[model samples]
Structure formats: C-alpha cells, structure tokens
Target: MKLRTVLGAALAAGLGWLLFAPTRVRPVAWEGPGLPPSRTSGPYADNGRLNTAELLAPVPGLKAPESVAVDAQGRLYSGFEGGAVVRFQPDGTAPEVFADTGGRPLGLRFHPDGNLLIADALRGLLRVGPEGSVQVLATGAEGVPFRFTDDLDVDRAGRFVYFTDASSRYGWPHELLDLLEHGGHGRVLRHDLHTGETVVLARGLNFPNGVTLGPDEAYLLVTETGTARVHRLWLAGERAGTLEVFADSLPGYPDNVRFDGAGTFWVALPSRRSPLLDAGARQPWLRRVIARIAERAHLPLPEESMLVALDLKGRPVAFAQGSGSASYSYITQVLPVGDALILSSLHGQTLARVPLAQVRP
Candidate 1:
C-alpha cells in the first residue's frame, strides 16, 4: 500500500511538472511543416573549398562573431560577445574597437556615403560614421518595440533601410526559446532615413533572421528562420505591399542574406539537417518537454557549415559546404566581396574567406 501511494505521488509530480514547469518557453501549437530534402547530400554536396579567414582571438575564446561587413579599403567589421564591434585590418592585423553599440550588433552594411549601418539586437537600427561616431536610427515599428533586431540592408536610393526583428517576445540568450516556441511574432521593418519613420512591412514571421534589398531595389527579402524560408515584400510598383514566400523548404535554418555583385544572394546555414528538429516541430508538448530537458542537458548544436546562393527568383544557384571536422561553428552570414566571399559565425573565434571560383560551378 505504501509503494502504491508513493507511485501515485510521483506520477502526480511528474504530470504536474510537465504541465506547469517554470520554463522560459511559451508553448504554441504548430504543425511542423516539412523541410525539402537537402541537396547538400549525395552527389550534389558542395565540396567546400575555401580558406578560413583568421581574426584576433577574443579573450577566453569564442566571442561569437555573428555578422561581417567590409569597407571599400578592405577593413572588416564584426560584433563580439559583449556588443563590441571590432574592426580588423586587411591582413587580419591591428584589431581595434570600431564602435561599441552597447547593445549586441548583428547585421552590418556600409552606406553609400561610407557610414556603417548596424542592426543591433539589443539597441535598434544604428549608423556608425567614419570616426566611430554612433547614432540610433530606429527602435520600434508601428508602436511595437524590437526584441531582436537581427539584420539589415540599404536600398540603392539610400532613403530607406530594411531589417529583421527576429522576435518581439524573446531577446538575447533566449533566441532558441523563440525558435522552439515557433511563435510567428517576428517582423520586417523599414526605417525611413529621411523622415525618421519606422514602419512594419511584414509581420507574423517565424523568427526572421537576415534581410537584404534585391539588386533591382524594387523588393526586399527577409529570411524566416523558424519556417525555413525567405519572405519577400514588394516595396514599389503595382505589387507594392504584397508579401509572398520567396523561397521555402530550405535544407537548414537560414541566417544572414547578402547580395553578390554577380546577381545572387548568399545565405548561411549553421545547423546540419536534423530530422529530430523537424519531428519535434510537430508536437508542442514534446518540444516544451525537450526545452525543459535542454535547460539542464544543454545539448550541443550541430556544426555543419553550409552556404547557399539564391537568385532573385529564389532559385538555388550555388552551394558551399564546410567541414564537420573543421574549426568553424554556427556560421551566420556569408558576405560578398569582389571575387570572394567572407564568412562569420555566431560561435566562432575567426572569420573565413572563400574564393568565389570554388563557390560557383
């Protein structure tokens, strides 16, 4: 009888914890959609032939450089673990603080006039001048304050900028929580540099990550990471205000978007293809339980290095693969420079550079 009593009590406790755990996850029921079969496998695998660009090591190792931007003169810029935007010389020498966003900076692009624009995850939209002067451009859109400003791109006209707010509910150190929750609380915001008005161009996104202006400058593209697709919004012409899925069923979670001068945009996928993540997306309770388990277990994220280039029509053009045996970790963005591509990571100690010839067929 005492054993029976103990069993009943333990059952109640277990069920209670499952139903009412003090977890950061905000559970939402979602139908885990299918990810298209990865072409990254089989004979189609990109042989990944590029040189890893080195950087000044962060103190204690792994500062997590999430994004990269280069000046015309070849200076590279990326933010470190504590929200410091560090710039390195052309030869990866003379590391110095370019501008401290004080809030974590993710996406970076230089304006036509040589000012640097940043999408700060903690702050908002920002601009860094030549001498390291900093200014806040926008923080909220349509009265919604940004919780995760992830990436940005400037149009040819330079009058407006498009950026992604990864989540409106979850902030830093909790991005995975937002991803696991699968809530469509993300958004794409356009900040008018002239009028200083920030407006939401699209909403109900699933953890949007990187963003870029199309080469034509008539439309914008934002990567919806939670859904494994890119969302396109038309800014001008008759289709203005129209939103559609530019690309879908990607091999893995897409990070930043960058336009190669040769008419393609490069996207980085840090995660290797995982059937477990796909299966968990189908069950809300299962994911919540997994999240709770992860709080203690702290499972490691897969370190597959992948970069895909898509044309304006959202067709995959080129694929570049890195190694699981290599030192790169969670590559976040692939920035296009003249004749080469630069890679950054959210959990890597150095930047990488790959020759364009190897990335293209």
Candidate 2:
C-alpha cells in the first residue's frame, strides 16, 4: 500500500512539473536605449524606386547567394551557402563556377595578386589562388576555434586582410540562437600575409559580419549585425589602435558592408530587428531558456530582408528594402557595380542587380 501511495505521489509531481514549469515563451522587458539613428539621407532624396523589370531572376538551380566581389575585368563573383563561388561576366552571360569551397562561403574579395580571399563560414579563412588552389589562412583565434567566420576585406596593399567572426556558438545554419543569446560573441581580426601574423583588432562584438576599408585606409569599418551598428578601428593616425562607433540605430540588422569609390558604403540587412530580440536582451534568463528550448526543437527564429546605402560619415544615403513576402528574402550582402547595386540573398536562389541611376538619391 505504501509503494502504491509513493508511486501516485511521484506521478502527480511529475505531471505538475510538466504543467507548470517555465516554458521558453515568456515576455521580455528590456528597456535600455538603443544605438543612435543613421545620419545620412536615404535614396528617397534622389527619387529612387526599385525597377523589378531590371532584376535578373535566379537561374534554374542556384541557391543562397551570400556575398559578392568584382574583378578588374568587370566579372562579378558571388559566394553561396551551398559552397560554390560563381562568376558572372559583364556581358550578361551566365554565371560559371569559379570554385567549389565544399563549405559555406559568405564573403569574397579579389586580392591584388589575382587570388581570392574567402571568409568561409565552415572552412575558416581561405585564400583561393589564381589557379583555383585553396589554402586555409586561419581556423581559430587565441587557441579557440572559430564557430562562424562571416566576412572579409583586403587592404589595397594586399598584405593585410580583415574579417569578422560572427559567433563562437552558432555557424550559419543556427544563427538565430546568436541573436537570442545576444552575448557579444562576434570579433574582428587582421591577418598579415607579409608578416605571417594574426591579431585580434577588436573583440566583444555583437555578431560582427561584413568588413570594408575606409577611403584612406586610415580605418576599417565593421558591421555589428546583431546590434545594427558600424564600428571603426583606426589603423593609422592619432586614433590608431582604438575603436569607435561609426554609425548606429540602423533600420535593420546590418550584414555585409562594402565601400564604393563614389563615397558610399553599401550594407545588407538580412532582416528587420525583432521586438522579441530587443525584449529578450533585457531578460538574460528568458534568453537562456529560449536558447535551451531552441536547441531541443531545432527551430529557427525569424529575420527580415532589406538593403541600405550609407556615406563615409555613417549616414544613410539610400534605402532599398523588400520584405520576406517580396521576392528578395534575407538579403545578406550588397556590392555597388558601376551604377547598379548587386544584391545577394541568404534564402533565395538568384543574384540581383538594381540600377542606382534608376532609383532616387
């Protein structure tokens, strides 16, 4: 009789725990002031409007175009989540495979010596030689292996390469957890091929992704994807070796950043900022629970799609955005080619280029 009574009590307790235990869906209440708003004018100033007719729809079998780079011969290069570096020629020809990275390639840049520097999410930093040979430049930092190597930028000298490690916990497939945790796992690092040295230029970043060198090479700008801010690290002059916020209060989560010769910086916002993410940052415990539950369920959180252009002073010069409902979903990177802006997507099959002249300033 005692054994029966104990078993009943135990079952009751178990049922009670299942019914009343804290789930991962509680409301968040964070209230800190967000970063400053963007200072530049948007494309609306110039009367820009998206011309859907000009956009090139995806080829029959492409997938998840992430980052883009251009060569001197006017050839466009794009890295894909499917591990292919595809090239598009200026003559409106079909894109051909430049190389198969065998890992998610997020960022691509043409080195002065004709090699391609790739920030591969799964394979770490790689240098693709002119002959298409692959070499790993970096795999870890400070004895800790990289969980996500997101983007890269090569200096004019070609001796220095700067890149971002988006997170230490999540690679591309489960990036939503990084947003939920909001623990500042991102970092920016510089690799010097001439000296065979690697240095952490900045740390404690919030999902740092795209990187670009400023006009004078005086500083390098990095985008903090989770926080919607761009940070600058001075490489020369009085501010040498120091970091400062270049721009903030972005309309959405900033991804890959690129600088054009015409004094504009292009940024890709994969998704709009989620109110839930803002709320979760205030309640660490809630975030922790969400992370734990997310691990168990293998569910992905939501993200938005958009693109914006900013000048050197970190002000918005133009805004080109599309929601998930639109054809452009999860736009990850933008490259300004002549008067057109080349757009890359994280969840779409094709690459797109919109004419800047067609859009207002």
Candidate 3:
C-alpha cells in the first residue's frame, strides 16, 4: 500500500510537469504536409543512384561541412560547426584553415571582386577577403536585426547579395523550435555591395533555408523548409516584384539549394519528413509539449541520404538516395562542380562526391 501511494504521487508530479512546463516555443497550430511518399514510390522513388558516393578528405577536427564554395582555381571551401572556414586543394587534399568567422557560418559565395560572402547564423552576413580577412557586411535590414542568416548567392556583377534570414524569432540554437512553431518569421533580403544598403525583399516566410539566383538573374529560388516548398521571387521581367511557388511537395526537409549553371538546381534533404512531427502540427499544445521534451532529449531521424534535382521549369528531373549500406547521411548541400556532385553534411568529418552521370531520373 505504501509503495502504491508513492508511485501514484510520482506519476501525478510527472503529469503536472508535462502539462505546464516552461518552454520558449509558442506553437501556433498549422497544417503540415501529408506523409511523404515511400522511398520506393512517387517523386522520391529510390533507385540507389547515390550508392556510388565516396567520402573525401576526412579532416580530424572538421565536421558538419554544411556548405561549400569552389573558387575558379577549384579549391574547396567549407564552414564547420566550430566557426571555421576551411579550404582544401582541388584534389580534396591538404586541408587548411582559410578564415574563421568567429560564428556559425551556414552559406558561402564568392563575389566577382574576389571576396567570399558568408551567411553566419550568429554574426549575420560577412565577407572574407582573398588574403583571409573577415569583414562585417550587414547584421540587420531596415531597422530589424537578423536572428538566423542562413544562405546566400551573389550576382555576376557583384552588385547585390541575395540571402535568407531563416527566422526572426529564433536563433540558431532554437532552429528546431522555430520549425515546431510553424510561425512565419523568415525573410529574404538583398544587400547592395556598392551602396552598402540592405533591403528586405520579402518577409513573413516559414523557415526559409536556401536561396539561389535563376538563369540571367531573372528570378530567385528560396526554400521554405517548414512548408516543404520552394518560392520563386521574380527580379526582372513582367513577373518582377512578385512571388510564386516554384516547387511544392518536396520529399524531405530541404537544407541548401544550388543552381548548376547547366539548367538544373540541386536541393539537399537532411532527413525525410517526420511523421511524428507532422501528426502534431495541428495540435499546438501537443507540439509545445513535444518541444518542451525535445529540448531535453534528442529526436531520432532515419539514416537515409537524399537529394532532388529540378529543371529550370521547376520539374523534378532526378531523385537520388544512398543505399541502406551507404556511409553518408544527414546531407545538407549538394553542389555540382564540374562533372561531380559534392555532398556536404552536418554530422560527418568527410565530404562525399559522386559522378553526375550516376544521378539519373
């Protein structure tokens, strides 16, 4: 009888804590995408195309190469979780520290003037010179400051830098929490290199993760990861100053997207859609509860690597996935360099690559 009474008391305490835990997440009930198609069907049909991927340049201290930039000389540059921007020879050898952003760097792009632009999560937008000098470019737009400067792209003339602020309500540490909230707190901004002026192009987006310039700089493609959709913001032509959906119903949560300059866009999927997360999307209270618990525990995701290739018309041209025995997972960026696709990840020490020919529809 005594043991039963004690167990009941503990159970009541546990229930009370779950019901009224102090959490930063203010989940707003929103409809999430339906369950994604199985890997063997629909637009995500698995074909073992990425099975031939091979790891390259495993540095001892470098991990989570979330994004990569290749200079004209073919040297590879990437940022890690530890605020380092590392450079590697064209052959993926001789790892060297190029520059340190002193904050988390998410996206990298080289300007026509030979400066590297970085979208740092903590320090906002920055630039690194050819001789390895870091410069603060922009930390906010208009009067509002950025909370998560995620990814960026530069025009050929180096006049403007297009980038995304992943969220305004959450910092890098609370990214997952922002996604859970499903609130529209993201924005697309452009920075003028010549005038040093910053402007917000679009605002109130849901977790806009990646941005890329379309052919001829006519349009910009920004990925809204929370919605599993990509938005097309027209820059020139009759559609200029308008926003539309470029692609929707992605198979997984996209991280970074890049244009190949050969009429294709590659998108990286860190992980497939989480059914558990989707199930609670319409239940704000449940998501808040889950977020509270998630802050203290890790959410396990499937061990599958995926990438999607889309044509200029926003049609899926190819879907690639690693085989079950594949070593690469948690991929964040798929950069098409020459005849190969360089794969970056957020949890591994090595970057992987596969021949472009191996990725077929």
Candidate 4:
C-alpha cells in the first residue's frame, strides 16, 4: 500500500510539472506540411547513395565544418565550431588557419574581389579579407537585430549580399526551441555592398535557413526549415519583388542550399522529418507541454543524412541518402567543385567528398 501511494504521488507530480512549468518557447498554431504516406516512395526513397561518401580531411581538433567555399584557385575553406576558419588545398591536405570570427560561422561565399563573406550565427554577417582580417558588415536590418544570421551569397558583381536570419526570437543552440515553437520569425535580407543598405526581401518565414541566388541573378531561393518548403523570391524581371514556392513537402529539414553553377541546385538535409514534430504543429498547448518537458530531457531527432538535387524549376532530379550508420551524417551543405562534391556537416568532425560522376549519370 505504501509503494502504490508513492508511485501515484510521483505520477501526479510529473503531470503537474508538465502542465504548469515555465518555458521560454511561445508556440504558435499553424498548419504543417503533413508527412508523406510512404517514406520509401517518390522523391524521398532511401537509395543508400550517400553511403559512398568519404571523409575529405581529418584534422585533429576540427569539428563541425558547417559550410565550405572553393576559391578561384580551387582551395577549400570551411568554418569550424571553435570560430576558426581553415583553408585546405584542392586535395584536402595542408590545413592552415585562415581567420577566426570569434563566433560560429554557418555560411560562406567568396566575393568577386577575393573577400569571403560569412553568415555567423553568433556574430552576424562578416567579411574576411585575403590577409585574414575580419570585418562586421551588418548585424541587422530595418529596426530588428539579427538573432541568427544563418547563410549568405554574394552577387557576381559583388554589389549585394543576400542572407537569411534563421530566427529573431531564438538564436544558435536554441534552434530546437524555435522549431518546436513553429513561430514565423525568420526573414531574408539583402545588403548592398556599395551603400551598406540592408532591406528585407521576405519576412515571416518559418526558419529561413539557406539563401542562394538563382540563374542570371534573376531570382533567389531560401529554405523554410519549419515548413519543409523552399521559396523563390524574384529579383528581376516582371515578377521582381514577389515570392513563390520553389519546392514543397521536402522529405527532411533542409540546412543549406548551393547552386552548382551549371543546372542543378544541391540542398542538404541534415535529418528526415519527424512525425512527432508534425503532429505537434497545430497543438500549441501540447507543444508548450512538450517544450517544457524538453527543458529537462533531450528529445530524439532523426539521424540520417539526405541530399536532394533539383533542376532550375525545383523538380527533384536525384537524391542521395544514408542511414544513421552512414560514414558521415548530418550533412549541412553539398558544394560541387570540379569533379568532386564537397560535403559539410554541423555535427561531423571532418568534411566529406563524393565523386560527382558517381552521383550523376
């Protein structure tokens, strides 16, 4: 009788904590892109193609090479978790420190003038000169400060820098909270390189994580991680200043996207969509309870790595994926340089590469 009473009291206290505990997440109820009926069908079929990925270079203490950029000379540059940007030769050897942002760097793009632009999660947009000098370009746009400067791309003429602010309410390590909240606090902004004018191109996006300029600089694409969708914002032509869906119902949460300078756009998906997250999208109260519970416990997330290749029109042409045991998982970006596909991850200790011919016909 005493044992039963103790169990009952413990259950009651747990329920009470779940119901009334304070949480920082302010969940909003919105429609979620429901999961596909079959995970092995359509554009999401697990073909195990990413199983062939191999580590590019393994530096002793380097971790989380989130984004990589290849210079005109084919040298690769990637940012590590410790705020160090390292450069590698074309063969992924001879590692050397390029610069340190003193913050987390997520996206990288090289300007026409040989400067590297970085979207730093903790320090905002920054630029690194050839001599390894770091400069803060813009921290925010309009009246709001950037809470999570996520990704960036520079125009061919180096006149503008396009970037994404992943969240205005949550930053860095709180991304899981932002995702659970389902609040639309993300936006895409453009900064004029000449005048230093920053303007919001699109607002109210749900975790706008990746930004890339489309062909001819006519349009730009940004990934909405919470909604599993990609949006195309027109930059020129008659549809300029408009937004439309570029891709929808992605199989996983997209992290970064890069154009191959040919005809394909490579999008890195760190993990597959979570059914539990989708179910909680419209239940704000339940999400609040879950959020409060998550504070004390670590919620499980998918661990597989997936990448999608889309044509100019956003149709899926190819897919590469690996199970949880795949060589390198949690891929954040897939950049095609020369004949090899360079891959980066936010949780991986080394960059990876796969032959381009092996992934394409």
Note the clash tally of each candidate.
1, 11, 0, 0
Candidate 4 — worst ten consecutive residues by lDDT sum? 34-43
Task: Compose the digit string of candidate 2's lDDT tens values, residues 1-361.
Answer: 9999999999998766544556443333444227434324543221214424144544556688888888889888887767888888874357788888889898899999889999999998999876667899998888767889999998888999999889876777667677676667788899998886778888877788899998889999899877778888898999898999888777678889998867888888777666566666677666666666675677543555467788888887677654324446577887877777777887767687666764335
Best by lDDT: 4
Give a tens-digit lDDT track for model 1, residues 1-361: 9999999999999888876787877667766658555455743365654324334434344378899898889998988778788888875566678888888888999888889999998998999999888899988887789989999999877888889898999886577778788878899888889999998888888899998888677888888888788878898899999999898777778889887766788889887656666788767887788678766665655667777889878888877666645436577998877777778887777676666787785
lDDT of 1 at 68: 89
* Candidate 1 vs 4: which has more lDDT: 4
TM-score order, best first, reads 4, 3, 1, 2
Give each model's whole-structure lDDT: 0.80, 0.76, 0.88, 0.88
> What lDDT score goes with residue 112 in model 3?
82
Runs in model 2 lying further than 4 Å from the true structure: 1-48, 51-60, 296-304, 323-327
Error of 1 at 246 (Å): 1.6
lDDT of 3 by residue, 4-82 (tens): 9999999998888887989888888887877677767777887778776788777787788899999989999998888
> In model 4, which runs have C-alpha deviations exceeding 4 angstroms?
324-326
RMSDs, each prediction?
Answer: 3.0, 5.4, 1.5, 1.3
Candidate 4 residue 251 Cα shift, in angstroms, is 0.6
| Residue ranges of candidate 3 with Cα displaced over 4 Å | 300-303, 323-325
